[model samples]
Target: DSMGDEHVWELLLPLPTTASTSMALSLLTFRLLLTSSSSSSSSEGYWSTDEFLPENRRRLRDRREKLERTLTESGIPYLPSDSGLFVWMDLREFLPPPPSPDESSSASSSAETESRESMERRERSLYLSLLNEHGLLFTPGLSMKNELPGFFRCVYSAASDGEFELGLERIGRCADAMRRSKEET
Candidate 1:
């Protein structure tokens, strides 16, 4: 069941515009056939198999390959998959982890109880501020129960290549800003 789900997910993701368009056309044709008074049962055969299925598959495959090549050329870390459109990037190394309670206490002379919470609050604020500033977005980690803080998931789509590049540049700027902010504080 898990394998089937994975297969289905792979198929759904990274669909080329042509495949999507073809599927839409197929649906429309099916609807028309159903409504037409002269619609023959034999005509139903044409709608059964997608006429542009091959072209759609080829286009999607080409797009995936192009994306992979681009990421490789840019030296961006990415997960390679034959079926899926997305190349999941690993950003763990790029992002700094939240300061631990002990680390925060050592860094600040302020009261441990209040300072620890305050520091955490500051870190979360900084992270969100960076995201907002750079136009970068991410889903907070699932393990975060009651706002566990600091964990997040960023999803980069392949649809808008230009937007992705802009977002990455913004992220770089945000990282620099974070470094400067940390140095000042």
Candidate 2:
């Protein structure tokens, strides 16, 4: 499997040695493409500004709204995003507390305190907890190797309607359990 990285150029037929024949063939193909039109009513012409139909726009809007509502109800904080379909969820508040000083042998002055590294470690721990215990997969913000900690990227647009709703439901339950567990400690 190419995994969407298919080397398409290699699959193309070798260029003709005679330059004139190649030029004629390219011109003919271009002319045919320009002349052809889609008989399907849903199909849009090349360079059409209105690529998404009204029905498609409504469906996409409904999906995004549902996902946003689900996250809000679940008490998961997320950044405001309008340009893309992905949501950058902020989960810093739900991260587990750092280890107590009494439990550690080595006295790292600032190590015991909350720092970027510590925060990243906690993010990883939370990611693993979600994966193993909740059967939910989350892309750890720490794995991104960026400054943002406890920020997981979630894509709800690609999933089917039923799948997306179920995922949201599971996430809500998982978030509840995680918060409760964190509080008990």
Highest-lDDT candidate: 2
Q: Where does candidate 2 have its weakest 10-residue lDDT segment?
A: 3-12
In the range 1-185, model 2's lDDT, one tens digit per residue, is: 12111122111111111222344664464344323422222143331214323433455567667777888999988886664445778887777766666644446635436556667778888888877888766667666565766788676545556767788888899889988887898
Which ranges in model 1 have alpha carbons more than 4 Å from their true place? 1-50, 101-131, 136-185
RMSD of each: 11.3, 12.6
Each model's TM-score? Answer: 0.40, 0.61
Q: Least accurate stretch of 10 residues (summed lDDT) in model 1?
A: 1-10
Candidate 2 clash pair list: none
Candidate 2 RMSD to the real structure: 12.6
